[model samples]
Target: MTKISVIVPVYNVEELLPKCLDSLVNQAFDDYEVIVVNDGSPDNSQKIIDEYYKKYPNIIKPLKKENGGLSSARNYGLKYATGEYVLYVDSDDYVSSDILEKMYSLGMRDNSDIVVCRSYAFSNNNLEKIDNEILNNDVFKRYILNRPSATCKLIKKEILLHSELAFFEGHYYEDIAEVPAFCLYAKNISFIDDYLYYYLVREGSIMHNKKYSDKLNDIFDSIDNLTNIFINKNAFDEYKDELEFIYIKHLLHAASLRFLPYEEGLPSINKVCEIMKEMFPNWSKNKYYKKMGFKYKIVCSLIYKRKFNLLKKILKVN
Candidate 1:
């Protein structure tokens, strides 16, 4: 049986796909299979995938499907992933050659349901490692909730299958909703401090687009989905505080985006603030709010006060 399955959701990243696939092909660990999902890109990405599939016929399996977003592509890939553990690698990002060996070793040793490693951001032809401490359940909840990207973690396949966890299809910011659910379902989790994943930050990416408000509804829907999951599992009381903190943080981020000197984001920001108040009527009194940094504290205070004009000015100045 394959020890690990690395799933790469290919979209239109033709230029960068070679780097990503090359990194996977050269990994020190060989007991893994690579599942590349071609999400109906109009570019030469399929040809590139064909080249790699031909070269590594035994290790690489390519799945071609219609244009579903990242979430759909990943969900489809999961169906054919017959590994004990699964890792997600974006088409535009690459990983260290030793990452699989290191993470898989630690995961098996610790019997971890989820194994997390440090990541680096590659921008402007430079790579800077992100700093992170060791993680326990308490620390993991707080840390993963804040940085909810799915790329840096290795999850047990059983956890996903048993919990019926899948990403929200056809949505932006889907990771924000899915990663936390994975963390909640995970029992024994481990972390390594080594920088194993390199996340590329480039223009025209889904995250770097200037128009943030277009996906605001999807973001809120993700939050609601998470809430429903917590409730159905009867874990709401146990995770209430953490969930509340995450909701508030997401709201503040949306609120800050409204300061982008665009009118389209204003209504979304207003709706975010309204939902924040409705959900946590006394949010200012929450312990998490009090422990936040001065900048967030001010933002929360201004949001509670409904001082959008002043908040916009303060955000602009900063």
Candidate 2:
């Protein structure tokens, strides 16, 4: 029988980790092991991990490591995993009881390298389900042209090994870079329509930090890394536009935040524009770029400087 390894990276999610673990502990499938890596969390996360380890010793293996961020924690967990397939679960997120059974069954039955399912986000008062079309569409192209999150997917361990793929350590947007490449290398994929994962949206999370302001060069640097991977793989020409569009959208969001006035923001915005010109010089002619209008342009113009008060007067950021 094939086994699945669930890699969950633990951090300072003491408040929500219990619910996440409870859901996993009760999974309908039994041929699985949960590899929990504690990424130097300062809270009571260690205590919780210890409790679970004692209760489910055979299924749960706990490893304590220094703070190395998300990518590092995942890489650490990968080494201890013994399952034929792997699924990544965030410490603050939970999964449906049947998620493992369904994902594993589908992957093995269909001989697929990747198995993807629908997921939803739970906030204070809202729940948003990701579109179901992902499981039905051409996953590789959709993945390249759209939002690609790894949490809702099950991947074959061999593919990662064959491709020598590991999450880029020390990076904030590792998934935003790695998941697509993994899919591009995939030969077969299976899709399940069920909402198998529950992603918690919490403030103070690394992804939600407002301090992740736009560093124009860094942003371009990351995009270039992914683009080069795709181009070298001999992916379609369509990827160039898709990659550029993705960066442009990121730039737009970073620029639009409530911050200092245009004067402060303009430098970053101008820097983004410079990168965009280098990546997609014809972006101005693209319908989406043209539709951004003056509001977006103004926000970009004020990315970094000492004009906070002026920025607030014009936009309701955050």
Candidate 3:
């Protein structure tokens, strides 16, 4: 079997598609295939995809489907993947060529089902490497607790298949719903400290688009789906602490911060807090909550206390 299948879900990224494709084709590794799935982009993305496929037919495996959003495109690409392992890449972003070679090697050596590499956040002309100290199975809960996005991670395709997992289609913040469940299914994991993924932080991306702030409601569905997934697997209590942290981090704190920015954001923030109250009412006693930095503790406290005005003012001041 091929070492890896790099899944690139393409959308309307005509201008940036070449850089993403170029990065993959020039990888130092050769035992991988790039599954570039175009999601009916209205831009010139398909033409660019076709040109690249023509140039490197063996390496570039192209799949064209209707516009079904990122999650749908990923599910489509994954359905036909023929690799022992899978790695996801966004067409608007790129990755270090050495990523697959290094990650794949470690995955095989350790027989780890999930391999993580640090990601570089690029904006304007600056590149900031983001991540913490190296991790392993010792910190397994951390995997499900942090960095919910599945982008750039090398995962065993069997885990996805056996788990019968698919990204929650048509939902915003699908990563929140999907990534933790994937991590839960991982029996072994590995991490690389190197910045192997380039994450483009551009304006108008899904997370940054404030005009669609109402869509933050989708995060609720994502969180709820995760809860159901855990229950179905009957692994809820085994990872209950991590699950609580997911609710606190993704729904309460992260969503509140997003809503705190706008004029009518208080109601949204309130909605997030209400969910936390209903689901994880004793969440303040969470172990990870005790380990959070002073600033985050303050933020969580304010949110828990339902202090919307004070929380907004405090966040705005910073």
Candidate 4:
């Protein structure tokens, strides 16, 4: 009889909102409330929400708020949520029919603070599943090394309330920064291999949308925040090597994105090189750091900075 509050942040996702809501409504789980936060979307998303609000008056509660970012919308929804367990489902994404019931049952049986499930990512022509578990006995280690997404999971409301965990305002990659910290703070965590969440990959979504030069910086900041949480908490020294691997992979991806013509001023190649050097001085040892053709990797290494000599040295060593 555990009540769950499903929070869906409604932005300008009018086209996909109905499908998302329909999936939720059709779920086998009955003891749940849906809280949809309307974050000043300019589109007819509000109209659609209103239609549903009228139809399902008792189960659906709509909270209208001015244009604050996603974090603000979620924080606003939290205030009105009355369920013992909380789940976040983006307006643009939909879940499998049994996700809520399965996640809730798992959490209840395990007395878990956080419950995670496998997720499917769908593009127009391709689909992929991400369901890897970290081998180390530590939950935080598993999170840092793999299973880093927020959408493929469920959490206990009391855990968040007791820890006072709130999303960082006006930031993208907020989940990346917050999810790891939650795992670190949690003592009871459980995972199910079953698929629950489906991330429909629109070609032009925000995360994959218009290239912004500063996007790399946002990504770096997220990694830096996640790293700081672990360091400050003094969780375990064994994670340092694994963390460096994660950092290198993160920087490489960010640095690659800078090569595209994003609107923001091109991040100084030097700044990226500087961060790569400071954070991951030696990348060859990191397991996930892939080995590319010597010159290609070296050139990529130098794209962050204008130091041809350093690139030369790396090229020579390789």
Candidate 5:
């Protein structure tokens, strides 16, 4: 089997596909296969994949399927992954040339199931580490109660299969819905604490094109999926405080702001307010709640008090 299966799910990313493939082909390590799944893109991404496959037949493994979302493409790629460990990379994003070698070495050294590293945002020819926090307990602090992107980690194949770490299909926040199980069930988890993955932050990206609509409600679906994961693993009681804080962070704060610019989104926002109150009435007392900044604390306070109109007015002025 290959040492690492580098899965790249391609859609309409013809322009930036070359740079991403270039980084992978020049890796310091060679015992790896690049599974490029073209999810029915109407672009030249297939031709580019064919060119790379012709040049590197043994390294570039190509697959094609019907038009599926990001989660579907990743799941399709996973079915063909034969590597000891798996790594997901977006077609529009490029990684450091030495990333595969570095992560593989660390995973082998510790026999790790998951190896978490730092990620940077690349835009305007500049890069900055987004989650550079140095916490006491690294993996839990990084994956739980934080933005868990599937692109930022190297995962063991067995642990994934054993725990059924499949990405939730048809979900906008698939990583947040599925990533916690990787950290929670791993026998050993390691941290590189270095920025190796570079994600592109620009307009028209999947995250930047946010609108106040039913799709935004998928954040709540993600939370419910995660909550079920914790319950099935019998971990909810132990991590209830962290789970409660997630409700406060996602629904009351971040997801609430998605509706801030649209007056018609008030009904859905009020529904979210009811769920938050019913499920986590004592959320303000959660210890992790205090870890947020002053501004977020004020916003959550407003949300908890059912002051949507006043909260909307206050958020608009800022």
Candidate 6:
């Protein structure tokens, strides 16, 4: 069997698809297959996929399907992944050549259910490394309580199959729902300190698109789903602190985004603030909350206080 199956969900990112595919095809690791799910991209993304498929037919498998969202594309690709481990790569992003080799080796050596590595965030001509400190066996806690991105991880296929995990379809911020579940279900996890993935910061991306606020409810739904998962496993008591922290942080983020210049975003922001209050009535007292930067602390206080006008003014200034 292949050592890893790299799943790339392609949408309308025609301009950025080649760089992503090039990085994958030129990877130092050869014992892996690249499953490119063409999510009915309206652009020339399929043409690029076809080009790569022809060039590296043995390693690249292109699956064409109707336009489902990111979650659907990833879930579709999962069905045909034949490797022992799976790695998700966004079509708009690229990775270091040695990423697969290093991550795959760590997974095998540690017999880990998941292997994570550092990543870089790039925009225009600037690059910033995101170096997350990984604590022992606390991958789930760290993920929910801190950094949460599905990329830069080599996940054992068995854990995903056994957990019957699938990204929530037709949702924005689907990774918020799916990645934490993987971390929670993982038995053993490993981390490599080296920076391996390049996350492109593009203005047109889902996260940057202000109009995507309409689907903001999906973020809360995903968080609720994660909470229920912990409860079902009777792990809630053990992870309550981390879970509460995550809820508060994520709610604040959503609320901040909605508190922007757009009027349509206000309703979602208000809703998120309500949920945040209900989830953690004393969120302001959280140690993590207290440790937050002055600006963020102010934002949190304003949101908790339902001071939208002040929050908007602060956001505009910042």
Which candidate tops lDDT? 3
Candidates in descending TM-score order: 3, 6, 5, 1, 4, 2
| Cα lDDT over the full model 3 | 0.85
The deviation in Å at residue 38 for candidate 5 is: 0.4
Cα lDDT of model 4 by residue, 14-92, tens digit: 9899989998888889889899999999999999989998988777889899998887888888888888888888888
**Per-candidate TM vs. native?**
0.91, 0.82, 0.94, 0.83, 0.92, 0.93
Better-scoring candidate (lDDT), 4 or 6? 6
- Name the better of 2 and 3 by lDDT: 3
> lDDT tens digits, residues 162-247, model 5?
53568888878788778876767887888897889989887775345555456777887887888899888898887787678768
Candidate 2 lDDT, tens digit per residue, 1-318? 238999999999898888988998899998899999999999999999999999999788899999998888988888888888999999999999999999988988999888988898898868899652422155565655445566888998877664436776776567666777787678887777789898888876534555544432244455556777778778747566556556656554553342223345555555665666566676545544455569765554444332445656767543
Worst 10 residues of 5 by lDDT: 132-141
**Residue 178 of candidate 2: its Cα lDDT?**
70
Candidate 6 yields a Cα-based lDDT of 0.80
Those runs of model 5 whose alpha carbons end farther than 4 Å from true positions after fitting are 132-138, 162-164, 312-314
Question: For model 1, where is the 10-residue window of minimal lDDT?
Answer: 253-262
Looking at model 4, the pairs that clash are 269-304, 269-305, 270-304
Task: For each candidate in the order shown, give its overall lDDT on alpha carbons.
Answer: 0.81, 0.73, 0.85, 0.72, 0.82, 0.80
Q: Which candidate should be chosen as best, given TM-score against the real structure?
A: 3
Give the 10-residue window scoring lowest on summed lDDT in candidate 3.
131-140
Worst 10 residues of 4 by lDDT: 257-266
Better of 2 and 5 by lDDT: 5
